[model samples]
Target: MAYGEALALQRDLAQRRIDRSLDHDLLLLVEHPPVVTLGRGSHAEHLVAPKEFLAAKGVELFEVERGGDVTCHGPGQLVGYPIYDLTQHRRDLHWFLRALEECLIAALRDFGVAGERRDGYTGVWTGGRKIASIGIHVKQWVTWHGFALNVMTDLSLFDLIVPCGIPDVAMTSIQKELGERSPRDLWGRALDAVVLAFCEVFRQQAQMVELEAVRSGA
Candidate 1:
């Protein structure tokens, strides 16, 4: 999906949920083309590449409302946008962030990766390298712009910016961790693990629905 369209979809879903027109929580998943996003907490200096450099590399950049520093998304990454209502769950952002980490960690365990959290960090890491980055924006307690898990993403993309605004922070992917043992459908497998873990952690029976269904208020 394009970053701009995804952002619009999230806003639409979030507004529907906030207005009580949407009856269920949603976790919309996608893999975006190469694009850099700046969150509300992003610093100008965090982006290393200039406009010409990124344009030449075919990477699009945008500013978003998510709560984090700058981050990039591309093919081979799993981006999950959970349009969840916090009122039905815990209303605390701290708890919500931790719960997101817990789900990612549990999902990583399925792939034999021991994911952990660093103090004062809001993501799941493994072997001192970040495997996933999480940033969200909640309006009226309805969340949008969720986590991005590196499944088989090119690590070189992180070079274009200071990932999560941390200097020299290493980003690792599932393909890098599993190497030759990784399945050909590595992205699909990772998505399955994440959905299972999300169901367990959020205590919701989530099933994948068509984009049209979601768009038409189904």
Candidate 2:
């Protein structure tokens, strides 16, 4: 699904939690429209596009409730939504975020891409350009929303906005950086890498389950 649709689904999943139906432990992977999303309390100046221009460009804007400044998501990006119960892991948000970064780092390592975290920043990076972005919201000790990794996303789309409010920082993709060594089967390899990373970093055995998409209101 698209990132916008996935965001809507996150809301739906949260509502399901409110209604006490859906499992608190869930992870979803999706991409988003070419949109710039700013987190809570982020400055409007961070976005380089005017409201009208963004609409004209077919890009949507969202002032999300996550815990970061601004970031972009579009096609060929891998966005992960991990809906997990923090209570199951001692309610350590820091630990959870670290684990998330570590998971991505491990996944990238499998592809010969060395992913690392900045001293104070959250997302994974290689050299100077950021390859992944993370912004999440937690409610009732349960977490939702998550990270977006640039697999083969159009790096130019990032030029239209200030990514995570960081200026002059480059953006990259696995395919772009790895060059000849990058996996030809990106989606398949990424799926396996991320799932493996999840199990390794979280120190838990996760059962991969598949479910058919339900029609709206069903």
Candidate 3:
């Protein structure tokens, strides 16, 4: 889905959750066309490319309400937007963020990828190169705009911005770390692993429901 459409869906679902119309937490996985997003705290200088350059390259730019700085999303990147009600769990935001990092770390381990957490950072990293970027917004204690894991993404696109507001930092991916493996070949397994990890980390039962069913509130 495009970023705008996904953002709209997240808002709708988050409101439904707040109103008690939605009964379960949702984990939405999607691939976006090339786009760069600036968070609430992001600075304009973080965007290395000019507006015309971005336009010529067909990359959309958006300033969103999520936490963190500038980051890029594009094809081959696995973006997970988790609309979760924190009222059921602990109401602490820091705990929730760490739990998310742990969830991704556990999932990466399933693929034989060693995902690590930097002492003072908010994302999962490996060998000093970040493997995932996390930026979220919580409304009424319900969360949205979750993590983006680099799968088979074009790392060059990241050159357009100072990712996560960190300069001179490198971004790594599953494909880049493990050559001769296509992300498509492991996409299903990765998704399954992430869902299982999320369930275990959050202690929630994950039910696979179609988007149409959710939309219709079935």
Q: Point out the higher-scoring one by lDDT: 1 or 3.
A: 1
Query: Could you give me the TM-score of model 3 versus the true structure?
Result: 0.96
Q: Best-fitting candidate, measured by lDDT?
A: 1
Cα deviation at 218, candidate 2, in Å, is 12
Alpha-carbon local distance difference test for all models = 0.94, 0.82, 0.91
Global CA lDDT computed for model 3: 0.91
Candidate 3 minimal-lDDT segment of 10 residues: 180-189
lDDT of 2: 0.82
lDDT score for residue 67 of model 2: 93
- Candidate 1 per-residue lDDT over residues 1-218, each given as its tens digit: 99999999999999999999998899998999999999999999999999799999899999999999999999999999999999999899999999999999999999898999999989989999999999999988999999999999999999999999999899999999999989888888999999999999998897789999998999
| TM-score for each model | 0.98, 0.91, 0.96
Q: Which is the leading candidate under TM-score?
A: 1
Off by over 4 Å in 3: 181-184
Q: Between candidates 2 and 3, name the one with more favorable lDDT.
A: 3
Worst 10 residues of 2 by lDDT: 209-218
lDDT of 2 at 58: 90
- Expressed as tens digits, the lDDT of each residue in 1-218 for candidate 3 is 88998888999999999999997889998889999999997998999999899999999989899999999999989999999999989999999999999999999888889999988779999888999999999999999999999988899999999999998989998788777654557777778888999999998888898878866776
Clashes of each: 0, 2, 0
